[model samples]
Target: MYIGRFAPSPTGPLHFGSLLAALASFLDARHHQGKWLLRIEDIDPPRSVPAAIHRIPETLSAFGLEWDGEISHQSNHHLRYETALHQLQENQCCYYCTCSRKMVAQRHAGVGYDRFCRTQQHTGGAVRFISSNAELIWHDAIQGKRTHAPASIEDFLLRRRDALWAYHLAVVVDDAAAGITHVVRGYDLIDETAKQILLQQALHYQTPSYAHIPIVTTTNGQKLSKQNLAKPLDLSCVSEQIAAALAFLGHPLPESLLRAAPQAQLRWATEHWSMERIPKRAAMAWPGV
Candidate 1:
């Protein structure tokens, strides 16, 4: 069974940009007759908005992107993150680093961490995964073959100095626990794949296949995001929004289906979903945004 997920951070209401990722993952899963799960990545409480948790699912429902089974919240899985962190520590695959961002920038001139703490025996700071020497290689479903040498990969964080579980660790653990066989998300996260793969190797977990769709960006070349104050999706025009998302993904619906219901548009999308049709570019400015 192919299990795919759209794990959105509950930082704000769902916007047109996020719909691209959510719709792509939903269509791809439905195309393969797989299960599509929704996970709320609210591990960082300071950044999470309580109202958005309820609003996100409501928006998805309004757009006819219903998920499978009960929704999973990252906040509910602290023990699992702790267990994975412990396993990595026990295997000597990770070490604590006390270097602050300012200190690292001053020392390494803004390059990735110099692994200064890797040998300094630091304690009580963020946990950093040891970069593997072998090349990180993977065939992305949409972006094609990707290869990164060990030197290009950094000793990324597994746990933050604030004690929150890092996304690299939490996402890898969650995907494995849920038996997710495929990960379809935005292209902006493409760079994070190597780090996650490293964690999977260290923990002996299966790495799901990856597909990074082009990200929707503003006219100024900024990715559409809450931090950028992108406007939320207009619930009054669900069908129109779905069509816009489909067209952006390189699968424009027929004229007759333009005014169809949300489910109808998605049904056509699921039947015709093609990873190859998506634009190969990393980011495309959202038209008329």
Candidate 2:
């Protein structure tokens, strides 16, 4: 069976950009007659808002984006992340780094880690995965063949000095463990795909197919995100929101369907969803935002 997931970090309530990802993932899964799973990416407790754990699902439900099986939370899967880290450690692909962000910035003026801690043996600090390969590349379903520059391909951290599992490590581990066959997400994460692929290779996990939808940005060209203070979607206008999301994906719905119920709108979208119609760009300006 084709298994797909919509993993949202509970840092804030769902916004327009997040709805685009959720709607795309949900429609893709339904179009393929596959199971759509929901996972709360609450690994970073400090950054997570307690209310979002409830609001996210409620918002998805309001938008008629129902998920299959029990919702998985990353916070409950510490053992799995630890096991994956240990596997990387056993493979000699992971190293302990004592360098802080400021330390690395001061040493390397360019992008990514400077590999200063690659030689130095540290006991307890951040754990970084060594990129043995010179080039990291992958084929995105939407953007086609993509390659990462050497500057972007560095020894990324698996675990932070703060003891939190890095997003790359946890995401790769969770996707592999949950048998996710397809990943439909926003394009802002396109750069991280290479790092995730590298981690999958090191951990000997099957790399799932990836389709990155264009991210919704503000008129100022800033990506819509919780950090950017993007407003949460108004559930009262669920149908309109769904229609707008579909329109943003290059599948504009008829005016009649814009006022329909959430389920009806999603039904029309799923039946007519076309991966080819999705824009290949990384970002698009959200109208009237």
Candidate 3:
């Protein structure tokens, strides 16, 4: 069974860009007769907006992107992340780092973490995953072959200094646990795919196939996100929103179907979904729908 997921961080209300990813994932899963699961990535409480959790599902429902089974919340899986971290520690793939952001920035000249703490023994600060694997190459279903040099791959954090589980670590653990076979998300995550694959290899987990659709960016080139203050999709205009999303994905719909109800629009999208039609670029200007 092909298990796909759309794990959204509950930082704000779902916007056009989020809907694009969600709709694409939902259509791909439905087209393949696979199960599409929803996971709330609320592990970082400080960045999470409590009410956004309730609003995300409501928005998904409004768009008729119903998910399979019950939703999984990352906030409830602290022990799971910890266990995974411990496993990495046991495998000697991780080390505790005491370097602060300021120290790392000054040392690396703002490129990324300089691995200054990789050799130094530290009591408690942050846990960084060492990318020792030589084969840092993977073929994305959309973007084609991707290769990353081990030297350029930073020793990313598994646990933040603030005690929050890092997104990279938690995402890998949850995806493996849920048996996710495909990852359909924005192209901005294409770079992170290699790191996630490295973590999966460290944990002896299967790397899921990846298809990164083009991200919707503003006219000014900023990716549409809560941080960018993108406007939320209006549920009252669900049909138009679905049509616009389909068009953005290069699946323009007929005028008749464009005015159909949410379920009808989703049904049409599911049947017509094609990976070849999706843009291969990393980001595209917002369609102004």
Which residue segments of model 3 deviate by more than 4 Å? 133-135
What is the per-residue lDDT of model 1 for residues 1-289, given as tens digits with 9 covering 90 to 100?
9999999999999888899999999999999999999999999999999999999999999999999999999999999999999999999999999989999998877568888898978767899999987888898999999999767899999999999988889999999999999999999999899888888989999989999999998788888899988899999988888989999999999999998999999999999999989999899998755
**All candidates' TM-scores?**
0.98, 0.97, 0.97
- Report backbone clashes per prediction: 0, 0, 0
Task: Please report the candidate that would top TM-score against the real structure.
Answer: 1
Give lDDT: candidate 3, residue 193.
86
lDDT of model 3, residue 162:
84
> How many pairs of residues collide in model 1?
0
Q: How does model 2 score by TM-score? A: 0.97
The sequence of per-residue lDDT tens digits that candidate 2 reaches over residues 1-289 is 8999999999999999999999999999999999999999999999999999989999898888999999999999999999999999998998899987898898878988888887888777899999855666789989899977665688899999989999999999999999999999999899888889889999999999999999999988988889988989998878888888899998888888989998888888889988999999989998754
Candidate 2: list runs displaced more than 4 Å. 150-152
Error of 1 at 262 (Å): 0.5
For all predictions, the C-alpha RMSD in Å is: 1.0, 1.2, 1.2
Clashing residue pairs found in predicted model 3: none
